[model samples]
Target: MGATMVEKILSSHALDRQLRAGDVVVASVDFAMVHDGRAGNALKMIEKMNAKALPFAHRAAFVVDHFSPPPNAEAANTHAAMRSFAAAHGARLYDVGSGICHQVLPEGGHFTCGDIVVGTDTHSTTYGAFNALGTGVEGTDLSAVLATGKAWFRVPETIRVELSGRLAPGVWAKDITLHMLRRLGAEGANYRALEYVGSAVEAMAIDDRMTLANHAAELGAKAAILEADAKTEAWLQAHGAAAPRPVRADADAHYAEVIGIDAGSLAPQVARPHHIDQAVSVAEAGTQRIDLALIGTCTNGRLDDLRQAAAVLRGKRIAPGVRMIVTPASRAIYLQALREGLIETLAQAGASVEPAGCGTCVGITGKLIAGDGEVIVSSANRNFKGRLGNPRAQIWIASSATVAASALTGVLTDPRGVAGGDWRVQ
Candidate 1:
């Protein structure tokens, strides 16, 4: 019985030398993160615990992202408290407009391969894109990590998802994850690890892999990881990160189940309102009207995502009666987009470009205040009822290209049908 990638990472972090699936261990966390949404509460709990110091303060990060710029007085106070706490504790603090924690952490080179990282955000699994074992934890659990730099886990069984073929035109990583959700449902990988494998996954860029790993939480996965390879090394080198020590699963590694997907067979996919698992092909979803089109979030707010949206929006105007919003995931990405004229392209298309943050995704600001039954086509993840603040406001999740194409037509239009540059499939 060879060790899986997850098993190897866990064993390295675990106090027990022979950690395995179903075994309990207190693993050391290399890095921990807390976002504004949960920072105040986590701080309070840490105070209650009377922790004098955090063992990993240098590696810990506090981000003021959700509800950035302070939507209201209450949120402002929370952000202030978080800022004060971070400063006093010597933990790295990313102020409002810095970016979402998930994006900022990796973009800042805080994450490295083979590290066991945990955060207060479910999307913390985004770090898995670097081949690190990242998982989300509750506030209490995070407080424990803050106090002692350790947390417990029951090693999860691994599910090998082998992707084959190449993505077709206008389709992207977002569609791939949505297709998986449609096949596996919401709880498909509950309490399990999803190990992405195969040629298609290997061909995916680091940003694309982040998109897949970020959605693992929606599938109820404990963690979603990819084997570190040359692409990973290239990304790390470009970021000036240390030379990578890649982690690989043994050839005979045991998997609870193996699933294969042909990426070439996939089309643009959309998740209907109220549940992420209720996904259907864009054509099958029909031409539904939309009031807003959002083109950014931690899931799809990287530079490449913005470029894709820009390609569709350049030299075009957004549809009448539709408000389009584009938010970069980080300050770095925002600046890069500006340098490339992506920001101007979106603005010229009648889209409102907001600061880098999780605008509207958590419903703190930029929310839809439309009539009942209004629809929004968003690139952000999660389309649950009232996720964007109004229970009556419906959300349709799709790729940035799809969102931009639909923004031009005020309906669910596929990018392939629109006037856009050739699709750049990875």
Candidate 2:
């Protein structure tokens, strides 16, 4: 049988040059990343292991995000330690305000096709948008990679997700991911690799692909990758990255399973509180009153996402008694939004634009929804109970456009209702 993309990449990096599903191999890592949340723990492990130096310091990055600006003295000390560790080990350290690690890594041209990149964050799979093998690891695993420049992996069976047709108006990659979550429960793809294929996926922009790949982990996927093509090359080129080496599965590649989806059949999807798989259509979800609306995160904080939100909030203002927050994923995206006046537009609409970082996505910092039974519509990935820092508060996950539209009326308003014309303030 012809080799799948995952098999090809694994075999190429494996010592034996032969790999199959469930086969364990020690492969060299192309890049490794850690954010402030896990950096202190990883550093402690390295010290405990008595590591003299990292074998691939140049390829490792330490990002001070997720609580950017230090919410407290303890966080400040942790950031200081991470910075010291990065400087001493010669690893690149992106200080506070640099943006989320996943966004910064790719925006800075550290990821490319066919590379094996790992991060201490579960959303590390975001890198797979570029056709790279990205996986999240624990602190112990990260420490081993840092000490030896290699890590072991059991080659995951590949599940081919074939996409056909384009998304309908008002729907987005976030909705698609949420739809998949609803179909395939939380553990559906456990220890498996989700390989997105077909015309619809190929037609999607890199940012959209990132949204799909970022949430694969929520389905228990070990990794999710898209086949690199011309669009991938164009995005890399536009970002000043070197020419990428595209990788594709062989024509006769074997897959564990094949699932087909018609993107045109999908509509706006929302994930209710306490579980990402608790998804329902906007109509089924009804008009949920919201006290806060958030419009950014690693999943949907790129320029395109911000622009879409800005387009909706242009002439309208957020509803009374509702607070809205917008955060860019990276410094570069923030600058671009500023140049395009997206910041002013959001502020004029009563949305507070915070610095580029994780913000309230990780429940680290931001004006979180207070009081029991409070509701928030956020574009971030997860909406589990207490995910936004209050167990009493509920979160509903949707696309940036949906969040923006909902912010206008302080309820779960569908973006389609506001698209194609000026939004009337109630």
Relative to the unseen true structure, what is the Cα RMSD of model 2?
A: 2.7
Candidate 2, 1-426: lDDT as tens digits: 788888888888886866788889999888899899888798888778887767777788999888787888877888999888888878889999999998999888887889899999988989889999999997888888888989999999999999899777677888888898999997789999999888878767777899899888888898999998887877777776656767788888889999999998988888999889999988889868999899787899988788878888887788999999999999999999999998998899999888888887966564455568889898999888888878999999998888988998888988888853222111
For TM-score, the strongest prediction is: 1
Top candidate by lDDT: 1
In the range 119-210, model 1's lDDT, one tens digit per residue, is 99888888888899999987788888877889999999999999999777788889989998999999899999999888888888888899
Compared with the true structure, the alpha-carbon lDDT of candidate 1 equals: 0.87
**Model 1, residue pairs in steric clash:** none
Q: TM per model?
A: 0.97, 0.96
